[model samples]
Target: MNREGINVDPQGRVAIVLVRARNPLNIGAAARAMSNFGFDDLRVVNDYDVPFAEARSAIDAAPVLAAARQFGSVADAIADCTLVFGTTALGDRRLQHPVELLRDAGPHAQAARMAGGTVAILFGSEKTGLSAEEMSHCHRLLTIPMHRGGVSMNLGQAVAVCLYELARDGAAPRTLPEEARPATAAELARYETLLREVLVTSEYDRRFPGNMGEDALRRLVRRLALQGDDVEVWLGMLRQVLWKLRQ
Candidate 1:
């Protein structure tokens, strides 16, 4: 579909993720929104009830609801997605990932999709928003602007707003001097493992035990927004350092 000046094919590259949605009707509403925005990929993480596909609110979005994929965890749901965005109302909870305003996220998301990378936008349940653990899987945190009353939105409405902003076209895609390709989750995991090994070998973990060091390192790496080639280079460097430390 043509969004603003950009052509966005929402079928393959963009996915709408509902995490532990309690009401099936809300799931249905989310599906309907996806249909309106021309997004077909819907992924549900963890357990949810409400016979989503049969939801009456889904309207003509039955196909999208019926075809939705279910996953046991956030990691599995977004494994194939190069960019994962978790939507939050920015409650009192602490966040590790970079937080972006919904308006600013559109161009970045569209650019990622245009670069042939899959993107997943995640929404939490009606009762509780995404836990810190679940949010850890996301590359960035997305928050919608709200009044100072501290009120949050319903799951369905949140999904609709995010999709609308993202699907709306604004400016032409920026040109990169080099072809831009972000690292896949698998690549990032490999680099994380190698880097962790180097830390252990270098006794960095010993100096900072528990989640302090590990979490900090993980967050630092994610903030790097490494490209595919950067992953290889870092992995090789970490491996070499690990070998030298062991020797």
Candidate 2:
């Protein structure tokens, strides 16, 4: 239930995806938090079913966990989602995607959902946060500021914090028309694959190896911020270019 005056996701366009989460208790905690915030679309990406089954058995998380869907990978989990945000601790790893502070992410994330797009927030496992491969699917990353440099919040706590921030100051939904909506992750992934093929066919990757890595190319494709309608147009153009390059 949304607060009396706040309606962040009136149409149920936001989803929470937990990737590789191993702790059933933490999963229960995350589900409980989702229930508190009126979000029920929970997706779990795990190879095994034990953790999810165990979490769903918890009485407190029954509402959210009972309806949760499990997936094999992040790509499959977020395929229909138009906006994907990954959470991270900003460790010693280099990041290719843009980063936003959690407090400031709510407005931006809400905007995306309001624009007739499904939004997905990805929470990684309890032991380690989102891996580089998992994060490549995200357009941006959000991080909660910590008092201590290396101290990281627990997986469940992190989910609660991020969702709480997202649910605050919500207003009336401002949905866009179908054609004006942003491209979904599956659409973007298709576009990225086609674009990469074009580059490889034209030997651009060979010419500029430094910027043609998987992560870099994925970031570059996302940076374009293509809309729903623009994806096919770009794909067609790239297909033509690739054909010509092959000829």
Candidate 3:
């Protein structure tokens, strides 16, 4: 069963975790940026070459990325984090109910300063954005304001904005235990199977048909490293609308 209540753990190294990111260069770039800000706790949750790209992007900080761990599932990456934040572009959508600001999150950091727990801030893929499932992993959602409408920043840019806010100096950690567990590969794969079937049966693939062959397509979905909760949210939507016929 899922954990009963909300528990926050303050006092730990904040992990700048990326889930299903698209580009190696961007991973390298984010890795470099994190190190610049004194954050070496980088975790890439994807079934791809996270370490390689981090090393390449390290430029001078290549070692930071090189030492970065690649997790096949999000759960493994965040097994120890006491708190988790998910970054989103949907400003004020109430994306994660009762979300906290980067400024407000400082308290938790302050609390954790000595408690020595960990925080994981998750970022999404580049081509589109974070998957519906990925967004659900976070205890709180962090969104950066932009002037222009429909404005979307690259993965590296998004990571930089978030890092500047939470991990920057003069912030305090929280006092709590931990967060919802990350999902297993078996759970994530079930959701992928659902999406894959949706692609095949739903009209999306046929209408905007592209080169999403099984293998290539699997890579795209797998990169997200979605959890069981994430999968359920997407499946719910597909069942309710996307798979339904227009009236």
Better of 1 and 2 by TM-score: 2
lDDT of 1 by residue, 1-247 (tens): 3635445654558889888887878888898888777678899886544554346345465677878988888998999998999988887777888999999887778788889999999898788888888898888988999997866788878888887786555332333287769999899879888878877777877887774366677787788899998888888888788888989
User: lDDT per residue, candidate 3, 72-176, as tens digits?
Assistant: 877788888887777677744446445665567666655654467777888887764666677766677766767656668877877776666654453223335
Candidate 1 local distance difference test against the native: 0.80
lDDT over C-alpha atoms for residue 49 of model 1: 44
The weakest ten consecutive residues by lDDT in model 2 span 169-178
| Superposed Cα RMSD, model 2 | 23.3
lDDT sort, best first = 2, 1, 3
By lDDT, is 1 or 3 better?
Answer: 1
For all predicted structures, in order, the TM-scores are 0.62, 0.64, 0.56
Better of 1 and 2 by lDDT: 2
| Cα RMSD to the true fold for all candidates | 22.5, 23.3, 24.8
lDDT score at residue 67, model 1, on the 0-100 scale = 88
Number of the predicted model whose lDDT against the real structure is largest: 2
The TM-score-based order of candidates, best leading, equals 2, 1, 3
lDDT of 3 at 179: 67
Q: For model 2, how does the per-residue alpha-carbon lDDT over 1-247 read when each residue is reduced to its tens digit?
A: 3556544563378889999999999899898888877778899999988999999887655688899999999999999998999998887889999999988777667788768888899998788889989999999998899986566798888888887777655532343345577899999999989988888888888889998888998899889888988999999999999889888
Local lDDT at 169 for model 3: 50
